[model samples]
Target: ARPRVGYYYTGKTGGTLFNEHMKKLTVQEFQSIPVVINDSASVYDAICTMFLEDVGTLFVVKQDSILIGIVSRKDLLRASMGKQDLESVPVSIIMTRMPNITTCKQEDPILEVAHKLISKQIDGVPVVRERTVNDQTVHEVIGRITKTNITKAFVHLAKDELHD
Candidate 1:
């Protein structure tokens, strides 16, 4: 007697099933709502926001929520240990400024963002979209993709496999 085997997904064209296809999942599937802070906000403000949101990273934005920078736990720690006063030091001075911040779109593959997180040695990336206003283009943050989210998705996939 032969053992029975269950298939995950079967396409109409009889394409590959399971087969590492989970990498095809898009960022929109797993991304979480972003925690944003204004560029002019104080370093103390950034620290408080991080604790309140329980997030490792914060996207720095301008008026209208246009992304201008990114701040991390490491940045805040370094700033706090420095000579500047945390209550008076602005986040813009410590954040990774524009043109250097890495971002992804909603339709981007989650696998791609995961690779970027590893390669760039960062904890997360802001999910952004371009908007046109009066003939000018700007990037507005919509969500955030983080290592924790990826791990959660991986666990979900493993659970599915076990049940199958």
Candidate 2:
């Protein structure tokens, strides 16, 4: 039989080493409530919704809440600067549509989501789940994973370790 190993300070038990635990954290544990908007909504309404919800990103969904696109503060700002009237312009004109929207599932590792946010240079990503409704498949936006959430989790982990 092999000899048993006791607790050893291998420089992996605290502080930055806490990141190991964070990497294994599931997205479901850190994902925040998703603020959604309809694809057909006007840019004016979308902006208002963003302000009311206090979110920088909005997940655009169909009438059935099927994920279709994503809109960010930058998109709104650009559209607002255009000559076109915000009340008359639909979000579909500026929203990043499906197939291009980066997403993470609830079961995805938080580190993976964090890498995606960093690699894509985005503020947030929608957390979705594939579901079949009326025999049609759709990605349903259930929550959101953002850089803020990841940072918050990391800080929380470090603080907990320090206290221990």
95-114 in candidate 1: lDDT tens per residue? 99888999999999888998
Q: Check candidate 1 and list the clashing pairs.
A: none
Specify the poorest-scoring 10-residue window by lDDT in model 1.
7-16
Pairs clashing in candidate 2? none
lDDT of every model, 2 decimals: 0.90, 0.89
Q: Which regions of candidate 2 deviate over 4 angstroms?
A: 1-20, 134-136
Candidate 2 per-residue C-alpha lDDT over 2-99 given as tens digits, one digit per residue, 9 for 90 to 100:
34676556656565666676677889988999999998899999999999999999999997678999999999999998899999999988999999
For residue 106, give model 1's deviation from the true position in Å. 0.9
TM-score of each: 0.86, 0.86
lDDT of 2: 0.89
Clash number for each model: 0, 0
Give lDDT for model 1: 0.90
